[model samples]
Target: MTHLRAGLVQQPAWPDKQKSLAASAEGIRALAADGARLVLLQELHATHYFCQTEDADLFDLAEPLDGPTTTCLAALAAELDIVIVGSIFERRAAGVYHNTAVVLDGKKGRVGHYRKMHIPDDPGFYEKFYFTPGDAAQQEGLGFTPVETSVGRLGILVCWDQWYPEAARLMALAGADILLYPTAIGWDPDEEGDENQRQLDAWTLIQRSHAVANGLPVMVANRTGHEAAPDQSSAGIRFWGGSFIAGPQGEFLEHAGEEPTTLITDISMARSEQIRRMWPYLRDRRVDAYGHLTRRYID
Candidate 1:
């Protein structure tokens, strides 16, 4: 496709799975009705940000690959004849879980998936305690591989993975047509106003840089509203919903605020090629000297 009409659903999630799923479905339907051939939803749209507190019983929230989240999204894709990208807390096996992104194609149904590689462990965000980092080397098609769908090859990455340029570069090298991030990020309510602004600005800048460097359009969908910590350990997170779509040159095609929004924008699929020809960052990469990147530190 030379041009693709994409939709991004940025909304708040609730603790109830059914409620959250219903909201996501509504946004998907609205976007599809707006003539969007592709729709993207925020991370863990089915439930609240449960990583705020890790409890053994919380494991019940994890579902199989063919669980309700994927099943529902697949059905929607079939119904609307539009490709949909959704996130899931995957229950891979006993005591093994991953933060995964699932792609549903209009014609092919469920096409591919990507497991979040970078797991963050912070005060308000304690993901390392819950998710097992994705091991790309252990499996054949598990790592930074793009999910091939009818619309295009989607390089789907979860929240923290968005920060790593290496992750984005690998996906681009593997032939990703576009980069998509389903994120659930927010600011600590206790943080100062200026600090929070800086955090949000940095987050936006890094993602746009990926688009500029890889010469691919970027789509980001983030949840909105404030989610209180289960254990009241902190003041909770006020999710800064700045979901956006950026062009190959890192130009903002569409942007949202800190509220529920459905971003609809038409991206020129051919622009990436034109931009790459102009910049040609990939053609000049020094791949041979980067072998030491595999090491943790030079010292």
Candidate 2:
């Protein structure tokens, strides 16, 4: 009968940081009213997806770990008596930045953060221009360890990290009860047919597989709406906001649409225990045989 109520806030980010923060706070309060103990916001919830283009000015968007964004979220968490997972453009130091997720504890204030490990450099996702890869050597110091909370130990990752099963496996092995991904991913408006559907399917399938493999619930919060390119050289990205939650057995617990929505669902820790006992993927892992994983290429 051990259960935890989780909430996912999937919404479009406004150009104005203050306005987006207000809207996000309102959404979090609403979820709290609905009995959610742990609420997660979409990646970079306070501002637009500045990574759409590689303007040097966008670097100004990054803030320190104890900056205004985290301060506001921590206060909100304390006020609402809930745990919040919020993503931010982190200004680690001068000329050093990272895509980070900050965990706010209702009673303890700002608890920890997880910097994004995998930085993507695709056509639309010019993340490499803006962010530095997280330092793996300081995993525990940088908040890679699951944040201990009243509901459960939360294993949080950012957008690009969702594709890598290795990251999920490491978190699960370290005693994470649930995996949470705060993502901001979308499709090119020009290619909105079979390709779009295929991409979305692949994204959904991969995350669900993580849940099944780790024997833990997985929750994803994605942004929605069309964000135009700053220079308007091409059609903007139409964020495919299909935020969802799946159980330990990869059963769909709740799903959202391509619009501003709030998804709330109850996760059963006992069910996770049952699934892990039955599946035993972790027990069967051949750790000693994974040395090749560290190599760039075997050939």
Candidate 3:
């Protein structure tokens, strides 16, 4: 039975970049000691969630592909001998930026990256102010393909992309054995208790559904803590860090609480194959009749 030990580092980003990187590196080292071959860090793990407000100066947070953040991750991956998926706010060019995930192979160093395609712009998540939507051409140009690592083919996606079934299906079709989401989502402090729970439940349910639908194991790493607004115009977000790994059947293999922690679990590639064979949802898909999906609406 082929198995892979995966690790998730769930923690809040600090105001200091070096401190946050140090924390993440420590978690990776611990997981490596426990035999985790692949580890994932949360979105923008090097710094605080800066998207809470839109400030022109915030663009400084974006770094180049070969910037300090990726440089540190690459060196850590090499030292720990673990495949690390680290998210970054990429400064693609002077004015162009993106929410990107860099995959560093332990032996190969910086291998490839996945530019986030879905850019969300809500009250709290003002991503549009900082990112340019990644298209197929840009992805191809940057080699944003499923990275083949020691564990399996990794279909790495950022936070907002997890909400789209189309993205999951595409990755599965492209031969990804597992799905990974590096996220930094939180609850609006203004919402009621029930509403907060509902939002969290929905987030978990949708991701689990992706696992079941695609017949692949799903891993998520989310930040945890309350990051206050700098200007205090509104209540800040409380990051709900329920980092978890779910099986191909949407069963929870391992789960974490709303605190800083490292979660390590072994997933069976053989089981994923068996489950997919038994379900056969992909074999029964009616692709010929789904051309309308490309249209904005059927009207």
lDDT (10s digit) by residue, model 3, range 1-299: 39899999999888789999999999999999999999999999999998888899988888999799999999988988889999888999899999999989986988878889889999878999999977676243242357677667898888999999988888888888899999999998788778889989999998999999989999999999999877686798999999999999999999998989999999998887899899999999999999999998999
Candidate 3, residue 181: the lDDT equals 95
Which candidate, 2 or 3, would have the higher TM-score against the true structure? 2
Per lDDT, the best of the predicted structures is: 1
Residue 170 displacement in candidate 2 (angstroms):
0.4
Candidate 1 lDDT, 1-299, residue by residue in tens: 89999999999999899999999999999999999999999999999999998788888999998899999999999999999999999999999999988888885788888888999998878898889988786243389988878888888888999999999999999899999999999988778778888999999999999999999999999999999999888888999999999999899999999999899999999999999999999999999989998999999
Q: Regarding TM-score, does 1 or 3 come out ahead?
A: 1
What stretches of model 1 exceed 4 Å from their correct place?
138-141
Candidate 2 runs further than 4 Å off: 141-143
Q: Rank by TM-score, descending?
A: 1, 2, 3
In order, the Cα lDDT scores of the candidates are 0.92, 0.90, 0.89
**How do all the candidates rank in terms of lDDT, highest first?**
1, 2, 3
TM-score per model over all chains: 0.98, 0.97, 0.97
